[model samples]
Target: MCGIVGAVAQRNIVPVLIEGLRRLEYRGYDSCGVAVLAGGEPHRARSVARVADLDEQVRETHLEGVTGIAHTRWATHGAPVTNNAHPIFSRNALALVHNGIIENYESLRETLRGKGYEFVSQTDTEVIAHLIHSLYRGDLFAAVREAVQQLHGAYAIAVEHKDQPNTVVGARQGSPLVVGLGEGENFLASDALALAGSTERFIFLEEGDVCELTLERVRVADRDGNDVQREVRTVAAYGGAVELGPYRHFMQKEIFEQPRAISDTIPQADSFDASLFGDAAAKAFGEIDNLLILACGTSYYSGLTAKYWLESIAKIPTQVEIASEYRYRDSVPNPKSLVVVISQSGETADTLAALKHAQSLGHKHTLSVCNVGTSAMVRLTELSFLTHAGREIGVASTKAFTTQLVALFVLAATLGKLRGHVDASLEADYVRQLRHLPAALNSVLALEPQIIAWSEDFSRKENALFLGRGLHYPIALEGALKLKEISYIHAEAYPAGELKHGPLALVTEAMPVVTVAPNDALLEKLKSNMQEVRARGGELYVFADSDTRIVSEEGLHVIRMPEHYGLLSPILHVVPLQLLAYHTACSRGTDVDKPRNLAKSVTVE
Candidate 1:
């Protein structure tokens, strides 16, 4: 994944470019650079540090231009070195910034080398610059159009030539690129969030679409070079929403914002309605007998939790698959199956590809459960539920995951209503539980001080084991993922019953075993699993419901949950694990917002 922002304006564009890069840096921050055609000549600055460093370099060097392209790279093909940074130029006559991978770059490099084109950086992106350079006879748009036809992989590129000031050419193949419309200026970025305050109007570039931006107009063309018009959307800046108010980190803010996020995701209703998703959802739910959920990472874990809800509550047979692996394997196609794709950004490349893969296999009825309403996944699906978790900036998702669970639970309840599995009393009770979730989450937030105390021990830990059973198993998996992601702790999760099968051998005093002990049917069996871990001299840190009767002992420590929320227990139980991971990362002094080798959105496969 990488970030791209470009501008063709009447005034100096360096400040706008830098600010955009700062906003987009969460997308990628290995290296950053900006190149502008200043007075019909190329002026540039780059850094292998944070985007702030790049901003300082541009300011100190007085780099300003009427036209520019900037990038924050997340090193896919090359190392995060200064030379490999973006704004890759061709003889200083043309400058370009790109996001995504080039699959046929090696061959393209060899072909360009035969034509006297020299490569400077060890990046696949450099080949595109040289290729565009060779194609530039006079027209920048023509050259870009010709160059992208030869590119074999996903890319969203913005190019500016020295010969053409106040003109920028942008193209999108498999990555996201949007055009921001403004008076006397137009912008291009990998995400609309980058151009939030800069502009309120945007045109989401379609696949194989190329566009040229100037001070006055924006032109778009299809892959075949046919002129086309894309609908312009007015998007809110939400700039104030992302601000960290009195919080140490964005992760902490998002963790504490869970109550509001969950409340917004599930509106207060006496009974869940299928119309809440979309008009087509009621008919589609009645037509489908099975559910197939495709997602990646945290979204995938949410889908796994949803599988239990969908099967048990709705009585629908559900299957959860990792999006990246779904297409590669052969599987049965069910026409009656409702295919669901879960994502936060909704631009996740693998998940989008998997959705298409499922569509090709005849799974026609589809739904998207994601945070962003304007994302590719939501646009492609027949029905969508936008989790109103506004702008999750932290690399490790907090509010987004919980909100997705809330949406999925609502979806399950709606399907149950449609399938006649849920009576009026049961449906009303589900709504009551949903409405009470926010207050329940606030109570869970009170346990943060205790969770922070646990983090003191977790900071010294190198490895950890998390155990859960049934629906909570996925919560354990998500907790392990969060711990490993932000805290740099190697953590693994397994069903409590599966510990003796293979993971039991890993138990020791050095290994901190965390168990999600809800007072459900499996609590007694989970207690037995705890005994096995204690027998191996492993210290157990348990997050148990008050009714579970789990007591603190010499080798065992317990933090009781605020409630045992029945069907919604997973949502309540995961908050403390999130707090545990957050505080542990804080205690370890790791970069909680931008963890190394991770991006906020995986826009590239």
Candidate 2:
């Protein structure tokens, strides 16, 4: 997970590169650096600091140039420190920024060392810079093309040389790279969102394609040194960086933004139809006999929840797989099965790879519930449902998760209609609930005060367990993940009945047990599970519906859900868990927005 932005222009492009890095800050970085060919000398500065801090360093040092490259690195090969920061320079006036792993770096480094190349920093990326510099042959693009042939594993690299003052060369293998076309200027970045401010037109370089950028033009070439053509496309209108207007942190702001996000994502009650999944969805649903969902992180949890909706409502058998693990394992694929991928930013590396892997296996019927229309997953999938959750800046997803649930609910309901499982009144009831969802979300947001009061308990704990049954089981897992992600607390989730098997042994007075107590058929069983926790001297934090009359007493605490949402309860139930994690992280003084060791969009696997 890293961000790369480069520019070639008539004027100083340092500001543009810095702004692009700021926009990319949400991708999660441990350090940031910028390199510019100032006065025909590659001048650079790096810091194990935030982009904001990097900006101040650039300003204080006066680093600027007409052509430049910048990087925000999430470490994989070395410790995250100032010395290991990006824009790794070589003695031959070359500066390079890389996004993915160089798997054969150790052997390459040893070979380079034997060739009289001295290394300064311990990073897989540094080897690339040194190798490129050693192989320099007066042409930057040609030299990089030759250098990459000697490398192994994934990379999206942008290289600039002091001698080549007006150009930047970029190459991609497994990671993503794109070219931004502008008037009298050209650019390269890892994502379209990074270049949205300067250019609307983009050329997405295919895997193994190397491209050169200058002030007035961009040229594309294949790995074998032949000229190629890449089609330039316009990006859809999208919101830029969100301002922290009134909230203390982006996580908090996103938690409160849920009401508006949910309202915008769900279709209007009057517009409810089989066409909600786009024109091709109906055909795909009709043709498919089973479902396979691929996703990672929070999206994987959303897929888990969708499995329940698909099996119980649509009568379709569904299997959810973590996208990163799906392609590596041997599995059966059905040509008639719909392969669904869920991602907030459609550029998630593993999910996209899994989509391609499934396609290679002859599973061509594909769909995606993604937020960005311009993302690669949308382009690769047969059909897409774009959620209007807008720009989710926080690394720990809030609005995007709920919005994906809304999209999946629509997909499930549409399949139900096609399968003749829903009557007119039942369909109308679902539509009515969609119309009332905004109001319901607003009421759920009201429970924040009560959640914060309970968060005082969570803040003091070292470990926690989440329990849910049936559909809410995924919600419990998501809650545990959120807590661990943001608060650095040890947390786990299990089905309520699974306690007696193995997890109940870990419950103690020091451990807090969080239970999802929705008033459904499983409520009584969940209560018995809560009793088991209580018997182990474990404190209880129960999220329950209004009618579930379980009150607060000894060793138990209850946070009431304003209303029971029936089939759509998971979406509402997750809000309090989000609040619980946010407040607990705040109480622990952890970074809520950009959590440690985690990036927002994982562009590299």
Error of 1 at 33 (Å): 0.9
Q: What is the C-alpha lDDT of each candidate?
A: 0.92, 0.90
RMSD of each: 1.1, 1.6
Poorly placed runs, candidate 2 (over 4 Å): 223-225, 236-240, 269-274
Residue range 263-365, candidate 1, lDDT tens digits: 8888666778888878988888888989999999999999999999999999999999999999999999999999999999999999999999999999889
Per-candidate TM vs. native? 0.98, 0.97
lDDT of 1 at 472: 98
Best by lDDT: 1
